[model samples]
Target: MSIQCPSCNSQRIITRDIARKLGGTTGAIAGGASGMAGAAGGARVGTLVGTIGGPLGMTLGGLAGAIIGGLVGSAAGGAAGAKLGEEIDNKVLDNFQCANCGHCFRQQD
Candidate 1:
């Protein structure tokens, strides 16, 4: 029941920590960028809403906008990150060789 090398049917499989690390880093960057973009857009909309309520209304509207923006951005970024992580895992990290057959192939999940 252990993981087997698809090509060589070998059990001597190695894990790649670097690939995971790189994937996480990539995800974080994307998330941060999206969050910032969302905040900017939210702020602009909030400002318009606040004009009707005056200073206090503006402050609340902006705060609300930022929160909403951040949440939406985070979700979108997280999804993008997961997709990227999978691609990295399949294309880069999954590259392994079977000691018995010497077959080079991607690891199956």
Candidate 2:
């Protein structure tokens, strides 16, 4: 499937393939960022839980929670970021115009 930019008509469209690639790259970055954030959050939670639950609880629960939270956060962030990135790429493709013919071209894979 292809996306057409209404402002530019059919002149500028973003191909699904290119958009996917852009999304992949964007998702990777976002995933890493999210993972880091999740890990930090998990650590904080672990600390809190440790204090409340004592040493044994902290050792088991904190470790498990951190791993699980980090993985889940990374996946969600990656997917969300990929979608947003694809949209932005589409917008950029839509606005670009050819200097010679004033024709906008859709991004190609």
TM-score to native of every candidate shown: 0.60, 0.50
The prediction achieving the highest lDDT against the true structure is 1
Candidate 2, poorest ten consecutive residues by summed lDDT: 8-17
Quote the RMSD, in angstroms, for model 2: 7.2
TM-score of 2: 0.50
Q: How accurate is candidate 1 locally (lDDT)?
A: 0.72
Model 2 agreement with the true structure over 2-106: per-residue lDDT tens digits: 544444455343244455566766776677677777877886787677877788877766777677667777677667767776677566654345443466554
Winning candidate number (TM-score): 1
lDDT of 2 at 6: 41
Query: Candidate 1, which ten residues in sequence have the lowest lDDT sum?
Result: 14-23
In candidate 1, what are the lDDT values of residues 14-107, reduced to their tens digit?
6444545566666666776788788888987997898799999988888888878887776666667766776776777655666666666675
The lDDT of each candidate is 0.72, 0.64
Residue 86 CA error for candidate 1 (Å)? 0.8
